[model samples]
Target: MVNLVVTLRKKSQGIWRSSFVRSVAVVASGTAGAQAVTIAFAPLITRLYGPEAYGVQGAFISIMSVAAPIGALAYPISVVLPRRDEEALGLLRLSAYISFFIAALIAVGLWLGGEAVISLLEIESISTLIYLLPVAVLFAAWKQMAERWLIRKKAFGVIARSALANSGFLNSARALAGFVYPSGAVLIVLATVAEVLHALLMLIGIRKRTTIDLSESSEVSTSNVIELAHRHRDFPLYRAPQNTINAASKSLPVLMLATFFGPSTAGFYMLSQMVMGMPSTLVGKAVSDVFYPRITEAAHNGENLSRHILRATGSLAAIGIVPFAIVIFFGPWMFSLVFGEEWSMAGEYARWLALFFFFNFINKPSNAAVPVLGIQRGLLFYEILSTGGKVVGFLLGFYWLNSDIWAVAIFSVVGVIAYSGVMLWVYLCAVRWDRDKKAV
Candidate 1:
């Protein structure tokens, strides 16, 4: 502990000393800190809002989650690709512009065809609140774009702070607001507030870090932005659909559960996903955000990245084993104790999800290879397969097995297999990239 403190102090003094470690620490610390707050408030949140209300909130989130990724046209993802900040800035503007149009389209569609949408999705509970999807998409997509710009700048510290601020404000708003309105609609409003706040914080961070980033001094124009868009066109063409499907697949358990079993089941599933997914989403995300830029740098300079990939996978796998084991073993008792008797079912779901999350954690950082190595078309195929896997897993469980537990269990099993395939594919791609770079 004493040595660790000294090391951290040195890190704080010289953040550039070890870029990868520093970046990971900043992002991981921020994510873990924010998630800790969410966990700390879970009891109060669960008690105040209850499972059914959470289910309602979860369904709406599921809808926006799918839309937000596509709304940005996935351009922000390639922001790290451009060597010049000018090109990056152009991509940023392009992504933001697309996001605005997507949000507007969603709002207009809802205004004109809200009833049709409700009937089509068989979701009447959130019909009144469906209009808020546009707001959610707009704010969330813009936040993603802003965050991507920071990532391009290697501003992990800024990104980390933003994560803490964003999650804290968002979750707090949801928790505190539950006491007042205590409806699912209130959660949506609070979420919109949090997303807008997070985006503003990121914008402020960008401005404070470098006036040049905020400046038109870069001379990015409509044609320049269009050129960059055409250059990374595959991102929007291939990656957007892939990401949307992946997100929609992730959202399905909630929607399917709510539609088939009821809101309480979906709520239980959402809580289960939240609790089990924390380590992967929090820490793996930190590693991935850092790794994406680092790998880009490596590929740019013809450097080998296999060692780095192996080290990351090993470290995440090691860190994940213990916590996930505990979740799988004692999930039910802990959920009952922490979240109340109503959430005990969520623990069962958590146990079933443990293997899937473990694989997912190992896979998250490696996912950068698709973008970095330009193997997105293949990745798109994988996404389709995995999305089908998830949907089919749930459907099989629901219809064939006639058991919710079986449904989730099959989904988790399929997820583990799908993630393992993706991890292997990325490893192969990284290896091939290294070999080809060396041969040159």
Candidate 2:
């Protein structure tokens, strides 16, 4: 009992004092501020655009979300892999080159069969936005590359600043356009503009804050970049597919709902995702981005990762529990009041999705551990199962069950279970790393 009490106390003390927690708080603060700005404009955006218009926007987002990961081929994740900035620079260039190549492929595909694809989603309203899909994917890739480089430097403040600017610019533009009478494609374009701005801001932030001797980077030849890409071939080979599965899984509700129900159903789904995603990204991504570097150092130096993981997991659970509890109970009421009655169904979606989001909240900080632990294949396999489970859940609800709410509930349950599995895998990886070190 005494040992248990002491351990608990130590963890409590450590949580308050850890550099990792401080960095998370800094980034979360900025992200919260950014999200607050975006949320503030939601009432206006929703009122002006309506659910059907948002449904069209949601369809555009779903397509771009899937393609974005493919465009970068998961190379941005390699920014932190190389110890030397020169090598990291090579990785960044490699990511850019791959992004352009992928974008060109998307452009060709769109030119050939864009309208037919949009017709399938029942979002023919935004068929014109299909051409912008490649542009959106390219911007997504660039934003990720810049953001990963900032993470390598532990520049949470810079990231925070850019995040705020990006949100402000994005929502402000959205509101301004909506006031002038906007179409779904216009709204999608405005969102894409925001991504482009964020990437540019990240570039400027890095330039002003972190100095890189491009002279060394310049010495790195095209061959060196190719070698760097090959060195991390697992990223494109394994991680890219994993990311695509992840993206597709997240967008499934929107895509599937639109196919069977209508644009309005997808709009409600999109709103729920928008609301939940704001808070989730604020903390989940902030925690994950900050957690990565510290864990990498611990794994490489043979330092024990158990305590760090324990503190993070406990703290994150506590952080997530209260808000999600409220969401599960009063999500519909909150959505109707905040976004108007048209979005009440969005709140219903949120109630079930809360369980899934909570699990994911706890999972995000540990996700980077997969690559560090050399268990990309394990994660990949689990991702396939998870995605498959989600699809089954959707199909069960859509066909046999014949209810959209049932489908969402089932999908959320599958996600909660799958993400729990992910958390367990990460813990085992840490334990295995420790065991190996002891044997050495």
Q: List, in order, the clash count of every candidate structure.
A: 0, 0
The digit string of per-residue lDDT tens for model 1 on 66-98 reads: 888888889989988888777878888888789
List where candidate 2 sits over 4 angstroms from the true fold. Answer: 1-17
Q: List the global CA lDDT of all models.
A: 0.85, 0.87
TM-score of each: 0.94, 0.95
lDDT of 2 by residue, 218-329 (tens): 7779989888888999988898999999999999999899889988899999999888776578898898898888888887788888666766787789988999999999
Candidate 1 clashes: the total is 0
Q: Candidate 2, clashing residue pairs?
A: none
